[model samples]
Target: MDGISHITFIVRDLDRMAEFLCKGLGAKEAYDSAGNNYSLSREKFFVLGGIWLAAMEGDPPAERSYQHVAFAVSQSDLPAYQANLQALGVEILAPRGRVQGEGESLYFHDFDNHLFELHAGTLEQRLGRYGMGR
Candidate 1:
């Protein structure tokens, strides 16, 4: 495989996550099933910015950590994205300490305790800022 094929999230409320994905992140529903055969559980599929995301009915995580999926976003649009998340009632985490040249981020958690990040810098940019030639 050249890269990530998809990412599946286990969530307490499948429907809530579906709404979060659709309205909060502009993910289009790709499929819906009661878990009859495909995944063997109630699940919702979505396509967000060309990435496939799946949410399956399950227990919310017992805890959360810094491990998260960071999606690329432009610095100019970060504020609007934050506003959208606020309007959607998502939980925003405190900004973590970052290196000067790394980039900026908005960290947040979903209803199921899944952390996500919208990053506003490229890997190359961060490397250069770190004084390492990219």
Candidate 2:
């Protein structure tokens, strides 16, 4: 099968989500439905490091969970991301324990309780560290 076509999030506010994506993660706003919904509801599109991310108007999850979408980031960029998110008044989650070689991560939740991760590790590095290398 082909790779992911796009990732969509059900957010309470399209504008807030757009700000979080653009200012917090450096995503560029590709399109805004602007009350014209060709899909389920009002939605906005963004391009994040070549990945298509969509945010739609809807009720978010009632509670937070570990389930989250992770974006690949450089190890050295974690601090910058953390600062940006903090300035946006986003909640930064404490990272779980990790092995030394697995690389670093920064986790946070958007206004609608959608969790996200900026991970510094590559799949190969994580697999090797976990002793599951191919």
Candidate 3:
């Protein structure tokens, strides 16, 4: 109830998802079964900048959409992050138009087509820009 406790992503390959989470999202591997004795299914856990993320082996989403989870980032780091993601061969999507003072974002997709965003703005800033007092 305080904040998001964890997020679970159903993916096709556990290793691939782990790689994306680590290399792209800067997540650390907290737990990995490595196909060890598991009860229900293959799964791995990571701490993405302190956010719990679990990837369980399974079929990916049926179709791609704008539905995505965005991580907060610093505006100065955005360019370098874009370059890194480019080097990793992540699919970069055309950025949406942004109003000044709202902040910036980098939108992209994982190899399996799950969309993600790295936003360089705070909730307070956005609310202020939108004329909603924080």
Candidate 4:
């Protein structure tokens, strides 16, 4: 099946953004080149979920071009993750609850104004619900 191997985003501060996704979101720093790019993960699989948050060394444009990125998380660990985010003063877009018929999801923005949706359920589940199963 074709699944997302990773998602990358541009940030204003590489270190701060990396830390937030690594520590607050439980994603481990998978790789770094000492430049401006970094990869983080909690597992190793071809269809697995991974992320890359990066920032250019020079000055960025007046306005960023992207909106946000949403990550998937299990419902069981959400409370703990929420607490960690709260401790860091991270703003949440939605409280812990079901989103209409979309199961459970928590929305938030990263340091680069990129929004993220942490959802529950497996890749198959997501595909089935969203018509990606075909």
In model 3, where is the ten-residue run with the lowest total lDDT?
32-41
Query: Where does candidate 1 clash, by residue pair?
Result: 35-41
Q: How accurate is candidate 4 locally (lDDT)?
A: 0.60
Candidates sorted by TM-score, best first: 2, 3, 1, 4
Query: Best by lDDT, which number?
Result: 2
Question: Against the true structure, whose TM-score is highest?
Answer: 2
C-alpha lDDT score of every prediction, in listed order: 0.86, 0.93, 0.86, 0.60
Off by over 4 Å in 1: none
Position 76, candidate 2: lDDT: 91
How many steric overlaps does candidate 4 have? Answer: 5
lDDT of 4 by residue, 68-114 (tens): 55567778878888888777778876455442445576777766666
Tens-digit per-residue lDDT, 1-134, candidate 3 = 79999988888988878878888777899998776938367889999878999888878888899999999999998888888788788888899998888889999988777899999998898889989976
Query: Which ten-residue region of model 4 has the weakest summed lDDT?
Result: 39-48
- What tens-digit string does per-residue lDDT give for candidate 2 at 28-83? 99999886789999999999989999999998999999999999999898999999
**How many clashes (backbone atoms < 3 Å, residues ≥3 apart in a chain or on different chains) does model 2 have?**
0
Q: What TM-score quantifies how close candidate 3 is to the native fold? A: 0.92
